[model samples]
Target: MRQTELSITVPATANLGAGLPGATLSRRLGMVTVRDSRPINPNTWTVTVTSTPFITGAGSATQTIPTSRVSYWSGPAVRHTGGGNLAPGQPTSAQAQTLTVPRIAFRKTSGNANNRVSWEPTLVIAIPSGAVTGLYRGTVTHSVS
Candidate 1:
């Protein structure tokens, strides 16, 4: 009887010139109700942000919700995969840092090559007191770089 041994190896390759990081809201905040005398409970919405790097560097991300008039919807807060809950300080503005990675990567690397490159964003909406009874509307914009 004869025995043979074989060796196999895989090379690490990174495709650096394909897709850009992107994000989108799962669904609109659609038809929230606010009363005249009571402060509304914090409403949380989910945002899906893809972690594909921008071909050159780790693609960063940010989110901003403009100040709303009716119902006084304000106090926007953001929580990313990282370990901190942060406030944007004002409406209609993005945070100063790159969005945190939702999980630790396989090789201590960032971007889509690491692992599942999707992030869930938690958004909070605050409706103030004494808001006029009417249909209110606003927009939240997200970006990845």
Candidate 2:
């Protein structure tokens, strides 16, 4: 018997461009690919995503954008292969969830024998009224299990 595992592939970087205070910046974080090769009964896998606060300058309140202001929507699978039931966490912008905590970005249920799921998740950041203008950096992490 061979032991396989779940894996994920994410983009190196994503830029949401510039936004003015009290404005919203939205962009797709490129394609995220989740692969499951584990041969197990009732094979199921989930991909969870989380992000850190975007900060610049001296990291003061005005220079920070909390993770709670960052919204994520899995939208739909760009493409998939060898699947079971693959679903998006947030199917629409109306249902987009904030990144305050780790959230299920995508999942697969009841599939076996090597499956792949790919999606382009969108991120929407609501710039606070007091936000300062500068380049902000944050980390968005994706994990599969």
Find the candidate with the highest TM-score and give its number: 2
Checking candidate 1 for backbone clashes, the offending pairs are: none
List the global CA lDDT of all models: 0.23, 0.91
Estimate the TM-score of every prediction.
Answer: 0.25, 0.95
For 83-116, candidate 1 gives per-residue lDDT tens digits of 2222332233242122233211111112211111
- Clashes (backbone N, CA, C under 3 Å), per candidate, total 0, 0
RMSD of 2: 1.4
- For candidate 2, list the clashing residue pairs, or say none: none
Q: C-alpha displacement of 15 in model 2, angstroms?
A: 0.9
Q: Which ten residues in a row have the lowest lDDT in candidate 1?
A: 105-114
Off by over 4 Å in 2: 1-3
- Using lDDT, give the best candidate's number: 2
Please report the TM-score between candidate 2 and the true structure: 0.95
- lDDT score for residue 43 of model 1: 19
